[model samples]
Target chain A: MQTLNAMPWATNFWLAIAGLLLVTLVAGLWRIWRGPTATDRMLAAQLFGTTGVGILLALSQAMQQVALIDVALVLALLAVIAMVAFVKRMQGPSS
Target chain B: MNLAFDVLLGIALLLCAAGVFYSRDLFRAVVMFIAFGLLLALVWVRLDAPDLALAEAAIGAGLTGVLMIDAVAHLSAKNAHHQGAQFDQTGARPQLWSRILPVFSAVIIFILLLGAIWWRPDAPVSLPDLVAESLPESGVEHPITAVLLNFRSYDTLLEIAVLLVAVVVAMALKPDTSEPEAGNSKDPILHGLSARLVPPMLVVGVYILWAGSYMPGGAFQGGAILAAALVFLKLAGFGIERLADSLLRIGLALGFIVFLTVATSVMIGGRPFLTYPESVAGELIFFIEAMLTFSIGLILFSLFSQAPPPVAPTSSLQGEQDER
Candidate 1:
């Protein structure tokens, strides 16, 4: 952590990762838009669950905001909960 | 290059916002909104506001997404008999002029806001510097926490009161039907997830509350996490909320009650309301914050759990079904 803090290259690497994750996030949006099933659309939020974590992790390093890693942990937790709620509610007492 | 990344992020946010507003399917719009929330959390990070980012991730992206998705599912199930127009209907397309007029007015308002920003003068007061100067006496190391709990604790008290009031109203609005117990996750996978996740979430919630003394984490964020954990356990099939009905009610208002007591007790010492003595101020803030965290968690969970049983899939011969 100290070495990364001292090195300019580390910042660049993390920034590059963040940028790539953003691109991936935007790419995943297509699945939500083109969804022929509700599950397909929900995959977009799952995409956010993973790629968003990666983005926060990268930016935490790039921006020197360690607090964001906690945010990422939280985002991961909540996103999965959201998915669970979706599945449970969608069952609608029939399943 | 940093500027390029920021601009790209801004564009992505705009795209998600547009997707949310324009999506034809209600489910699609809700998904778009969740995506928008993820982007908004990133934007908060970019703005150097980690506290806001944490709150947004917990409440906006996660909880709101679940609530909206729940509502959408309920809507579909409630109107299950109505074919072709249940989830897709935006209630008839608006007249061209009605849509155009709103957009036109929005553009005009946007330009006026831009002009205001362009002409606004620099403030004479530097609030952050003032906060920093008073930091040592404020009892907490984090400026935001210090300000929120010490210099302006009355506002935090009121915020807790507001949360209490919101939950009270939700309780009132809850249908009179005997509430069915949630947290019966018959799914084995959900069972596994809850067992593993809930403990860590509780630890993280307390850790966040502790971190508020020196970092971005605070009662609201920690409380939200605690609530999420309860929500998780409920979803995982635990039946925890029902098991402790009386305790849950007390937990919902305990924070406000404690806060008001502390605020008034200081009057015996000749201090104004909410002014903690400098000697024990830090300990006092932490005590209040811990209670607030628990109360907040319960309050938020009640809001989610008490929602009108999702209008239930009634009207069939199965109208007797209690669970949504």
Candidate 2:
């Protein structure tokens, strides 16, 4: 139990992850803004989805709550489905 | 103990993100996003969220990657003539304020949240304490599993519903199209290699599902692996027709149906909704998870396929090439 109180490494570990995810988010935002096509923007959105999952995991660890992980799982599931729908739309009616 | 490992993981994640964001080819960008998902999953494990790591790898990277590639293919088919057209040509939109404002705001938000967490010294510690106290009776050893299935079973049930709704909505939007002709013949070498690879992938997927009870692996991880195997087969020109048929529908519905039936039965047996009988709670949870893996895999595969129903077999193998 004393080890839990003294775990500075754990805090630092999560902070590092958070910092990196923020960097990813910034890069992804650039793609969203500068993408040359709709598909490219969607690809950027997928990047955001992955980054969001990482952030959620880091938050769950920092807060010591498992519930946040569930949120991440649900978000990942939804993001994939949405990407699929958009892909179908872009394909148009089959010739 | 190893700070270097953490640094490596962080670097990998950043690189993958950069690839995803900067790639010129949309297809390559989607592939890089999948790799980024995998790297992020590793980061989650380093952060002590293995359950999340599993879900992230499976759903975040595996399924999402498939979906993105599917969209890319669809877009390519429609916009064949406009493949390289620039999406945003606002003429090098230099935004001194717009760019600075978002970064500044994000930084402020991050700082404020961190400060609040640090400042709240007496924030309630009830959840961890409760989880520790109740874990013994949970039948499962992992705190996350206990939380997901025992303590918060209701949330898990509804989450399955959400997955089902997504699949249904995707189906509604895209009616089934005629199967693409199986195009350009696959290299015989690649086909042979895939045949050798797929069986082992299936074995590993099952092992992950079974091992989840006592270990970090679980249904989501297993299902994602299974879906990946199927995707591999589709890419290699094997099993594309079967995947789109009754098999796909069954796989998608298995988790939702099993969970709902068991949950409703619990209420019928004079317990609250989703309350598993204490004696067999662990077994029930395992069963539910197994079903979920299958369902999740199917739902994800269908989402990627985007066809309302399975495509019929064609001799040319163009469908497989199209998938690639």
Candidate 3:
């Protein structure tokens, strides 16, 4: 907590936003917990993907590590591949 | 605030893990597992290791999820008519002793880990400092890349060989059912997405491989991206397996073959197995990484492609079109 107060305001702000993203990320887990349908659960996973990218970007600013942005880039691009796999496999059985 | 974020992230990770463990639905468990991967990547980032975070992000993004989902589909397909529960996973509740025994062992392991951390000894030499000193001769500016591709390249070679063997096993386990794959999907949106994204993924794959020279990227990451693109193509009905059979085997072995060639060829010069002449070390590492990128991509894609279909012929769904 003391470390939070000692930081510059911009870093603090980004860190706070990151915390908020984490909270929403946990919130998305709700849909996963009691998903009425598999597709609904899949949507929650997608939400986690997008928010995960945002969290990385926020942390990059707070930590001032440019490498994190590259992590964010990699996450952003590869995240969709999960959906492709899901759709292809899911469709195989039902349709 | 950073601490706060880390704490919250930790809690989220625990929650996802619990979801995966306790969920009755196999699909839900898999979904929670996917969410867990993203959170884990974040955890890796907070720990200041972008290299691990990159690898986790790549694998967590899709590969494991695809394999597990394929397995779940297989299970359900096999049990399509008989089982009362379609996607429900078995073994939800175990005998009390069975559960308690695992819990007890896990606690013991946790204690041992904490004790190990508490009594950790100071090293005779600082490894990172040693790496920094030798960074110049490493053939790459990036310390991690240097260590992976140059300093400890023997480990890298063996790792590629292991991947080759794994892919080989997957290829053999693949039901020699002859590849018409239950009809390639004709989804227009999927087609559009694949057409647009695959080229960029290929570009990013090569870029990551090239970026290994100076940054937190490498052949593994690049190869993963390449594999993902191939997977995208597979999903979008690219008919990759329909290409040459022998060529696919060659592609799968290329990385290890090239790596071994480099290692043994250097031995004839009477240098240690992987020691490159100072002049060509950088070029040699780059060339090996490029071959690795292509082979690793193919190897990973083979793992996904080789999974037996969820159901046998006459799928649970409609007409089983054997397009081959």
Query: Model 3: per-residue lDDT, tens digit, B1-324?
Result: 777888898899989987887666677889999999999999998898887888888878857777777776676666666645433546466677875786689789999999999999988889999999999988899999999988899899889989999988887887666658776656788789888888888888898889878888899999998888887788777778675889999999998899999988998989989998889999999999999999999999898888755553224322211110
What's model 2's lDDT at B52? 68
Badly placed stretches (over 4 Å) of model 3 are A1-7, A92-95, B83-86, B89-92, B312-324
- Which candidate tops lDDT? 1
All candidates: DockQ: 0.49, 0.06, 0.46
TM-score of chain B of 3: 0.92
lDDT of 1 at B229: 89
Q: What fraction of native interface contacts is shared by candidate 2? A: 0.00
Q: RMSD in Å for candidate 3, one decimal?
A: 4.9
Q: Model 3's CAPRI class?
A: acceptable
In model 1 chain B, where is the ten-residue run with the lowest total lDDT?
Answer: B315-324
lDDT of 2 by residue, B97-181 (tens): 8656866897899899999998878856689889989887887877777887779978877887887888788777774555553
Task: Quote the lDDT for B236 in model 3.
Answer: 77
What is the full ranking by TM-score, best candidate first?
Answer: 1, 3, 2
